[model samples]
Target: MKERVLDLVFLIGVLFKGLDGLLELVGGAVLLFVTPGQVQRAAERVTARELAEDPHDLVANLVVHGAAHLHGRSVWFVAAYLLLHGLVKLAIVVALLVGTRRIYPWAMAALGAFLAFQLYELIVRPSVAVAVLTVLDAVIIWLTWREWRRGRELRTTWRQTVAWVFRRPQPREA
Candidate 1:
């Protein structure tokens, strides 16, 4: 039951990351085809509705203000960032799900780096979503390490069992 729970945790992490990557990929592709003017107009409409619904929402206000300030180059940058980020995450998810022992350490390193960056950003910006994601990343890192150790132990035990099974019996005493 404990092993099953561990496997479930690992699988959940992989699925979450895979889904996030898919969203990023789809969003980036869609953004690439949208004109800056369209984005600005859509942002304005959404902002107006959000402000009308609740004028005191700081996040909505900030998003509206930022949207107003975006340029064509900013849109392009966003698209490129989403695409690259999605690709890398998807690759990591695949490697992890495939149980690539060599990639586990690197995956943990990558996640740690991202988590550190997110922590810094959370400190600077203080978003609830970023904070939640940072926590999730930390958990995933722990799960990955646990899974790796479990795999190593399983492999070692399997090797020992195989050796024991295949070993020839000692010859009769002289």
Candidate 2:
């Protein structure tokens, strides 16, 4: 009976992980759609900065030279920022999924940790959307690391089978 209960708990945990993965997939898709343009502009601005530039000075310059001119362009600016943010997040999720074959158990534990963090954020300290997304990204990273350690063997076998099926025959070496 205890073993059966434990099995149920394990199954529930797996289901929860699946749900978390799905959420990440959705979030990633949304981010991809929302985060490219703004990122480009931000990247451009950062690239323009010389070494050892003070952050406050940079902000002041941006507000004066960039934001000041953008009173009429605020909506576009915001849209670009959102899109770029989402795209970066999407990229992270993709990377996590890619590594899953090598790290399943670790992935499961990390997903649990992520859920715990989200509970804390929602119940104890509500943050802005950006901060929440950042937390979610951290959780995904943790999950990926966990999966890497636990899923390596399963991944190896799967990979070997795939190679066997698709591998081209080579001529005998002289």
Q: What TM-score against the true fold does each predicted structure earn? A: 0.68, 0.29
Minimal lDDT window, size 10, model 2: 3-12
The 0-to-1 C-alpha lDDT of every candidate, in the order given, reads 0.76, 0.47
In the range 27-94, model 2's lDDT, one tens digit per residue, is 44544454445544654566456423655564445443443334335545444554444344344344
How well is each residue in 1-174 modelled by candidate 1, as lDDT tens digits?
Answer: 565555556666767888998898887897899887776787778788778999988777777766676678988887887787777788888776554578888888888888888899898978777888899989989987886776653234334545655679999998
Best by TM-score: 1
* CA deviation > 4 Å runs, candidate 1: 40-69, 152-174
The total number of steric clashes, by the backbone 3 Å criterion, in model 1 comes to 0
- Model 1 / residue 63 / CA error / Å: 6.4
The all-Cα superposition gives candidate 2 an RMSD in Å to the true structure of 16.5
